[model samples]
Target: MHAIHIERHGGPEVMTWSERPDPTPAPGQALVRLGAAGVNFMDVGARSVGAPGWSAPTGLGVEGMGYVTALGDDVEDLSVGDRVAWFYHPGSYAEILAIPATALVRVPDDVPDETAAAIMMQGLTANHFTTETYAVGPGDTAVVHAAAGGVGLLLTQMIKARGGRVIGLVSRAEKAATAEEAGADHVLVSSGAGFEQRVKELTSGEGAHVVYDGGGTATFRSSQLSLRRHGVHAYYGPFMGVPSLPVTDLPNSILLTYPTVQDHVPDREALVTRTAEVFRMVQEGRVVPRIGGRYALSDAARAHRDLESRRTTGKLLLLP
Candidate 1:
């Protein structure tokens, strides 16, 4: 098997596409033959910041879509050749690897392999953002930063499906079309200059009921400013470095939240339920993930460079 190995994390060059012995399934695990692997910010964080649960000289991804080629002892919930997608499983940037059989989400027949891998983490995060974080309702307005990006596109559609109006913030003019197509009631160029004022104007002077920011520091303050008094500022990811916004600066009684899908999934059952809901939403035509780009298994380095460039839109994947 081949995988992207990072011996000493520093830059994209550290990820070397190299050969490794095929892994054997341990108890309750299944050997998954990789189809597609999702390249996410978390993977970049692992490579850049040396995030926990990883040491040097390991694979570089945690979410992917694959097939069960073999199963270990006592694993009966899933069988061989079953197509599945998973989140938080290590060594995903490989041709084959072992994963807990129970952690796999059965991908629907209609969702393509790339699409399934792309949505597993991003869509699951979106599910919790709207349904749990703030419970966006009818007549509510939301400002979704990075509205053309992976989770933002899905999150925008989900909020709209739940009857909330969206004022989507995009970094460039090129992204405006995608955000609007994703059901953003209003799309504004998120130049980080006067964007909060634009959100207020879009909402007729009453700020948005909820603000969903996945771009981190680049859009943090504007996202906070777009919120109404007592509105929810849902800070999600750290794409442009984490922000140091002061809690004292927020309006009185406002709800400031930082939700991660990993932290929200309390147990195996919760993980299964959240993933199932994301899959169901896709099946119901409520959430659609845009596959911005796909790189060959050996070209993982190029994928990381493109993702950090901020020029690419939607989900990026690696085809194994």
Candidate 2:
């Protein structure tokens, strides 16, 4: 099998495409022939910062979509040739991967492999963020940082589908347009001064009901200011480097919450069920996974470089 492995953590250059022995599925696992792999900021964190849960010299992707090539002895209800997508599994940046049956969700025939791969982690994160963590509701207003990024775009659409008004914060005018096109009610360029004030004005001085902040460190303080009294602040990612905040630093009128999909949705059955709902939304055209760029498997390093430079928008994928 051909896979991209990081022999040691450093930069994108550390990712190397090499041949390795094919993996054999253990009991309750299935072997999948990879079609597309979703490249996420978490993977970049793993390569750049020695992210937790991944060892040195490891295969680097966390999610993908593929077909079942074989199944282990105890695997049932899934057969060889089943088309599926999955997330939170390791070593997915390969031509083949061995995953537990619980991690795999059958992709509807109408959904393409790339869309399935792109949505697994980002869509599920958006689902859990809006539905479980913050509970966005009709007539509610929310703020989404990195509003043109992969999860941001999906989160924007999902919030709109739920009848919530979204204020998208982006770094550039181009990204503002992208966020607006993704169904954001208003787009604010976060590059200028008084951006937090602009968010307050957009929400008619009430501030946002919730703030979905993924760009950590740089936007942390401003995100807190954008929220209303007793509003929830869901911090899902740390793409800008982790922010340090003292519990006492929170506003007296607001509540602070930092939730990750892994922490909020721990049950395998619940994860699968929630992910399936998002997939159904995609199949029915209620939510669309935007493909910003595509690269071949061997060019994975270049893909990482593009992502870290902030030169890409929406989801980037590696075709194997």
Candidate 3:
């Protein structure tokens, strides 16, 4: 099997495409013949920082969609040739991956492999953020940073579907248009000065009821200021860098929460159920996964470069 591996943590240059031994399903695991793999910021972080507690040369990729070619013992519910998608497992940037059955979610037959691959990580992250963390409701207002990015677009659409209004923050006018198309009620260009003031104006001086911030340090303070009194702030990612927040700087009455998909949905069954809901939305045309770019598996380095350069929008996938 061929896979992308990072011999040492550094940059996109560290990624190597080479042949490796084919993976066999272990107990409680299934071997998937990957059709597409999702490229995420976490992959870059893992390569740049190495695993939290492991040594170098880690296999990259966190999520993908494929068909089950073989199943381990005790995996009876899912048969051979089951189409599935999954994340939270590692070493997925390959032609074949050995993933635990617990991590797999059955993909709808009508859904394309690319869309299935695109949704797992970003879709689940958006689902947990809006529905679980803030519990955004009808008539509530939300401010989403990086509004045209993968998870941002999905989050904005999900919020809209739940009757919440969203204010999208993007770096470019093109992205603003994309956000608008994805159901963001208001779009703000974060590169300009007075971004926070604009957000405040959008909410008629009251500020948003919730702020979904993923841009990290650069927009952290503005996110705090964009919220109304007693509003919730959900910080889900550090795309720019880890944000530093002082307790004193926060509004005394507001609630601030840093939630991750893993933290919000810890049970495998619950994760699968929520993911099914997301997929249903996609299948029913209520939610759309914007697949911005596709690259061959061997071209993972270029994909990483494009993502880090901020030249792409929505999801990027690798065809295996």
TM-score of every model versus the real structure: 0.95, 0.96, 0.96
User: Model 2, 68-159: lDDT tens per residue?
Assistant: 99999988879999999988788888998899998888888888888999999999999988887878889999898888999999999999
Candidate 2 at residue 164, lDDT? 94
Task: Give per-residue CA lDDT, model 3, range 74-151, as digits (tens).
Answer: 897788999998977788889998899999988888988889999999998998888889888999999988889898
Candidate 3 TM-score, true structure as reference: 0.96
Candidate 2: lDDT over CA atoms? 0.86
Where does model 3 exceed 4 Å of error? 51-55, 192-194
Choose 1 or 3, whichever is better by TM-score.
3
lDDT of 3: 0.86
- For model 1, the stretches where C-alpha displacement exceeds 4 angstroms are none
TM-score leaderboard ranking? 2, 3, 1
> Clashing residue pairs, candidate 1?
none
lDDT scores of the candidates, listed in order: 0.86, 0.86, 0.86
Report the lDDT tens digits of candidate 1 across residue range 1-320.
Answer: 89999989788989998989989999999999999999888888888877678777677999999999999998988889889999778789999989988788788788878888989888888888988898989989988888888888999999988999988888889989999999988888865646888888888887889988777676777777787789998887764577775678876367888898877676888888888788888888888889999899899999999988878889999997
